[model samples]
Target chain A: MVIKMNPYIEYGKKAFAKNLVYRSDYIIGVFNTVIMVFIQVAIWRAIYGSNTQINGVPFSYVATSFVLSICFAAALTANDFVLADKVLYGSITTELLKPISINLCIMADTIGNNLFKLIMQFAPAVIISGLFLGLLPPASVLMLLLCVFSLIFGFLIVYYISYIIQACSFWFTNVWSLSVIKNSVISILSGTLIPLWFLPDWLAAAIKWTPFDVIYFAPIQIYLGQMNTQEIIFTFAKQIVWVLLFAVLGMFIYKKGIKKLCIAGG
Target chain B: MRKLFEPFSFYFQHSKMLTKTRMQYKLDAFLCCIAVFVRESAGIVGVFLVLQTFNNIGGWNMQELFFLFSIIFLTYSFLVFLFSGIRDFSNIVNNGEFDKYLLRPRSVLLQIISANSDYFAAIGHGTLGLVLFIISANSIGTDWSFANILYLIITIIGGVLIQASIWLLFSCSSFFLIKTDSLKDFLYWNTRKFAGYPLSVFPGFIQKLLMFVIPFAFVNYFPAQYFLHKPDLAN
Candidate 1:
């Protein structure tokens, strides 16, 4: 039997290819990410001066976690600005009439764009940090494979969160600051700026229950061998559950948003 | 005197109109303020987490670091509030609205900067910074002498000037590229992320780069150090 491919993945590929045309634009983006990562690593290094551990995780592990978190964030924060614009200016009307589901198309395109960014921006960043600043290697081959899957889950979690923010444009009409709030909250809660281990115990535990930790913290934990096999599976299960939940929530929001837009003649 | 007064009066008038427009969309304006506040608070939380982990980064404790962070944060909030038009310069230039500013009788720079003063977002960020400032000051037992106050005021104004010039330089590139928003975002926004931390945590070369090339060191690092009476490390 022949296998049928998802058409939305084709949109992802087209979106990926679209970015290749502007590959030059991302050179500075990679450079900026590298510099930012370097600055972060340096701060962590200073914090760990003459010391080996930060809240049970070694300094090196924490640095590696930061590297992964920063790169993942750079790669996965897909273009909500464009989505917001489409909603704001009534261009979403035509977008809704597309052959495939609008949300699927947008997510596919975002995934493609983020895939390109992962290769261009995130790959170089990891390489630079690995060479110069000492990014830690994945624990084992199995952990490496699991880490990659977790990163995909992480991306989906972020994508859903961003989708909700974009969908807010229907209700709020001018939800630009909502994006800023979303990003900042993600950066903190997802362990982009600081590892979950460093957060206050109660706060860390609280964040673990949210989808934010599944985005960066869980993968970083797996990469650092902080989680056992069963723990890794459980973490992955949690991420998958969050992804499904957010995906459903996103679709519901989109449906209601579209209805509101139609009724309001936006 | 009249020439100088004209710009201030124009800014005041434009700001009033902008505030009124913002009030028209009361819910959005309120939500935007809360959003900005949340973003700023998250940055503080990041700082709090890091300092909690390390106890002190370089020679600076959490209170001292918060002071440094607040200075940059408050100044940035002020810049965003007063000169939001400059931040949106690329949009204006790209959409041909810049031609309108150019055609105005007033100073083109003044007219451009006064176009969209984002008072609500500014207040949100600024209030966060002010709150942090008060917290840090109280925690550190900061000397509230007249001299210290004068120095703090001057240094803060200088920091604001540095930030404004950075924005102006990057935004001015829109004239040549006509699509400089991405570049501006990269340069202006990304670089500012490093401002909250102590410069001493960075390598010597990065320290030199921040001090000389970008002048971000002046934004908070050097000023906070001087304000706190720490020995100069730049020299």
Candidate 2:
């Protein structure tokens, strides 16, 4: 019996194998994640000194938020230049000639890389840091499952947004500044740098209108049981809407960018 | 004196050429500066929001915290301006470009140091640091006497040297390891992040790590204490 293999899966495996070559990154990544978590937790501890609860939120919630957010940030390692590099280095022609979808290939590569990170870096760092710094138990098993479900959508939202930015390279030729700006905006507005609770009410409300919060904070809230059944459903729906929105936007840009693509060298 | 100054002249000539090449893409350069400024400003905004929520962290208020961050930013900008080559040494080694330096008549270290600089990062970070320094220095009410100003200058110079030496040490490791990026990120960047906050905010071991292991405490925290005179630093 003959078997057919998926090209996208092969691309994913290739990406996964590529990361294996950097063995030391796996080790240092754990320490990096731990130290980053520690720094934020220490700062938060100093902020909450001598106070068990501030504004009806306990200290453990903030600690858990940092631990989860940093871990997710570390694991959600989508390379912002994956598509841009191809376009810049004149490799996009070859990528386009391939029968497989370039977008799917990029998505597979990202998923593969993140899968390695999740198992190799994220699990260990989460376990180690969660032990050193206490973590609140998940709202429940059902909530934990739903949080993971929502997190997948969060990853898609981030990935599609990055794709849209990378697509700009056809016009600009260098998207580094745009990527930096995107990362800064995301980190600040998404509650990755500071919990949204601490943000002024106006700023927090402004953030809600954007898709940034669904990336990290929404999953966190679901895990912490901060959301009720209705709220959880609403949040998940919002996440799906963002993923679809960004995906459509990314496709539009990629189409226009490809139409105008220019390669100077053979 | 001419013999002694030869390398300095060479460095200036090399840097001048590099700056000219960088300026060819003026818009990219300007955008990069703004990108870095915005990136760094996010952290400051985070701190500001935190302080707004909680009036003070470990007895260091907003202005004092901004002053502490400004010191690190200014010193780091200088370090990047002078020693970005060392900061990116692993790439040079991995790409087999280090041999070109060895072939030169001048010192390998001098070639490495003078070969490249990141003026964009320097400008971006320097602008932020200067703005924060001006605002915080005015509000924090530092006497800014001759001695105090001189002390600040000395402290900045010391910080640049301390941080540059740390980068040099890691860059040297690239000769053997061939990839010290993650190691540098762990030892240098992560510790630098910790240094942004007051040393008293961390645990005892972290404080010790900052003081003895990396000495980043001296980079910003101790100098900040000299000016702010926080109660925690009395010991």
Model 1 Cα shift for residue B223 (angstroms): 2.3
- Model 1 misplaced regions, further than 4 Å: A1-7, A81-83, A262-266, B1-4, B232-235
- For residues B94-202, write the lDDT of model 1, one tens digit per residue: 8888887877798888888887887877788789889989989877766789998998888878887888888788778888888876676666677677778888888
Per-candidate total of colliding backbone pairs: 0, 0
- Over A1-266, each residue of candidate 1 has an lDDT whose tens digit, in order, gives 54334888898999889988875578878877777788888988888888887556777887787778887787777676666778777788788786567776787788888888888888988898778878877888888888889988888888888888888788877777788888888888888888777888788779867888888878888877878878988888998899899888978887788788732355
Error of 2 at B190 (Å): 1.5
DockQ of each: 0.71, 0.82
Kindly provide the TM-score of model 2 when superposed on the true structure, using C-alpha atoms: 0.97
Candidate 2 per-residue C-alpha lDDT over B132-223 given as tens digits, one digit per residue, 9 for 90 to 100 = 89879988868999999999999999999999989888988888988888888888888886688898899888989999989999999888
Highest-lDDT candidate = 2
- The best candidate in terms of DockQ: 2
